[model samples]
Target: MGSGQSAPTERVFHNEIPISFSQDLVNRLEDNLSTPDTTPERQNTLDNHVRARIQAELARLQAEEVHVREQIEAVLERENLDREKALSGAGAGETEGGREDTTSGNVSSSALLQGDLEEVQKKVERFHVRRQLDNHPKVKDARDAVLQCYQAKTNTPLDCIDSVEQFKRSVAEMERQFVDSLRR
Candidate 1:
């Protein structure tokens, strides 16, 4: 009734619009308006058409992104296979004269051997400690006496209190001797 140009209404779903979508829409709108055939009367119609096209473009880009990610994963898997093949090929060419290639694999193998050596050393140390404990005359006699007492009084362990105490004292003395030996 007045000037035929109503006031611009506030957009209802402003927050729902993505920045990229809005930017593309704005660029297209600018292009459409700059053309000679465009008129102010058809601006809304052109804007609607541009918005639809932008939505379609966003969907296409998302699909392309998923496809590109899949391709990247395939390429990485292929590269890993090639690397394994190269390592195996290098290992096959090594001569059996105890001459090993100086690759990371050889280094890891040496590390594994070192770990095994350390484990063996620990076992040897344990064996020596056990032998020393068993070979001590006092400890050996006390252990044998305790075992005899327990066998004689299986239902009454309390009766073997003296032997148990002797075994404990022998163990303490053996530990002291071991520590003294270590200090020397």
Candidate 2:
């Protein structure tokens, strides 16, 4: 049971039992048990030392957290500025005057961060549905003409050719206007 010792390390007889540990473990146990920290003065001193160490560590961690927060805030402010500049079309994907506006002087970081991105967010939301009908009435009239021509000339479809071409041209014009608005 114990590395096949020549002599039994532990002996137990009936209800009485004895344990034997290695020399190093026995010495460490004795050293811990025989410490003079049992006195009230030493015990109080040890407790105070532990408390001081804990407080110090907590202060260090709080300082580190403050530093990290400042860094994150700085980064957020910078990113907000970049987004504001891009959305305003000041640079329009050009990085030449990105660091500071040469013509308009230096833009304040606070001003950039002041926007809650509400305008930019609204524009982004509208971008997906930007193809709203600007001249819906005209397109609808052309489409109705094409449909009516197809209905009237079901037998000779070639007779509806002019109406179909008119409808296509109207739709093409609407698309062109939509594209132009996006450029602005």
Candidate 3:
């Protein structure tokens, strides 16, 4: 009413009087015109019917989804098994003097062996310094001496050791030397 709008037309049916009352009267008039049976039991029954229908549909969809997932997993497992069998037959022809039918199996096995050889080569390259340590007399002597010192210090029980601090310092120095040697 404050917006300066014209008032709404009052709706009346079947020989009724015009309503010049408040908004609540319009609501009541509309409710009465709609239906006579607005009981709590009827409302609850409608709600329960809709809820049951939705629940049944949800269960049907879930079962279909589970069936599809199981089929996909089975197909994947079969493919993996076939691939593994092929890889195992890779070296058969070479071992049998080129007489075996090594198609997929031979190829996959050879590929796996090649991968293993490359990894071993990489490890050898990384440990080149450590592998050469055996040929150096000075490095070997120092390593043995440090290990001996550590073994002697840590050999006794804590209560039996007189100077725990001195032992700890010596052990720490030996550990530092071991790490420095590894770097070289």
lDDT of each: 0.76, 0.74, 0.65
Give TM-scores for every candidate, taking all chains together and pairing residue i with residue i.
0.32, 0.40, 0.35
Between candidates 2 and 3, the one scoring higher on TM-score is 2
Clashes per candidate (backbone, < 3 Å): 0, 0, 3
Regions more than 4 Å wrong, model 1: 1-41, 92-184
Candidate 2, pairs of clashing residues: none
lDDT of 1 by residue, 105-180 (tens): 4333444456657867976886687566658999889999999999999999899999999999999999888776
Output candidate 2 Cα RMSD.
19.4
* Top of the candidates by TM-score: 2
Tens digits of lDDT, candidate 2, 1-184: 8568776778766745577789999998898799845668878998999999999999999999999999999998988777656655655233453433422334444454445366568667667556466547778899999899989888998998888888899889888877876765
RMSD of each: 20.7, 19.4, 21.4
